[model samples]
Target: MHKEQRDGRQEQLSDILGKLFTSRGWGRKNDRLRIESAWAEAAGPELLKDTQVLVIKRGVMEVAVRNAVLMSELAQFHKRKLLTKLRAAMPGVTLTDLKFRAAAW
Candidate 1:
């Protein structure tokens, strides 16, 4: 295949994927996945070891931390920064709040 033909096929595939994602409402899910993958990067290695994102619903993210102390620390000191990082990483999704909780896992 020629270079021009390959470029056109690539563009067509991109458009088809975009439409499929939009039609199935996967865009939000993709954004959530991006945010989830970004958590460790945003929180740093120390915080990442203790924290896990449980769910994101209605613009609120519920995060589980290893202990109450860590939870409190995140709630008090890191929530806003994490939120900002999430917002920057996933601009198409609205992440309005973070809820931190102590986790058994």
Candidate 2:
């Protein structure tokens, strides 16, 4: 209701949520909505699928497309769109390069 009451409630909720997650061994980042975008394919096919993130610290992102032709296709056409999507998902998470390579091709 009051300003001070609202502030207190917010703090209390933050503390409670922190404690609950800590007790469960779920780190704070677990609940964080990670990067979800076409660019996320670099992290792995499944990492982004399950965790909603493309946690790559390196500028180069490794994605196994299995076909050099398709990799080139994506790099040329889809690269820009994928970058845009990743930027939209994680505004401050800077990613500059996409390294599309085949694992077996």
Candidate 3:
């Protein structure tokens, strides 16, 4: 009822929500979504549609491409530019490299 009581309750609510997000892995999910969005923007819609963001182990991001030709192009030519764009887009994310694999899906 009092201002102090309301403020304390608000702080407690904030803490509870923060813990819930962490415990439920919502934070990681959000980070994944952000990463996907950044990848989509950087890779362009056409490339994104044929590729999937598999995982991020250490600082390397593993991407699955639909075909060997695209995979080769990405790995051989676009790798550097893509990495730079990804890093710039996701400044907080630790993205050291992009590894592309030919995968059927």
Note the clash tally of each candidate: 0, 0, 0
lDDT of 3 by residue, 1-105 (tens): 222455464345667778899999999999899888888988998898999998889999999999999999999999999999999999888988899988888
lDDT per residue for candidate 1 within 1-94, as digits (tens), equals 2123544643456777787899998997976677778776788888888889888889898889999988888889988898999888776778
Model 2, 66-85: lDDT tens per residue? 55676687778877776666
* Best of the candidates, TM-score: 3
Global lDDT scores for all candidate models? 0.82, 0.56, 0.88
Query: What's the TM-score of each model vs. the native?
Result: 0.69, 0.48, 0.83
Give residue 78's error in model 3 in angstroms.
Answer: 0.2
Off by over 4 Å in 1: 1-32
* Residue 7, candidate 1: C-alpha displacement in angstroms: 33
Clashing pairs in 1: none
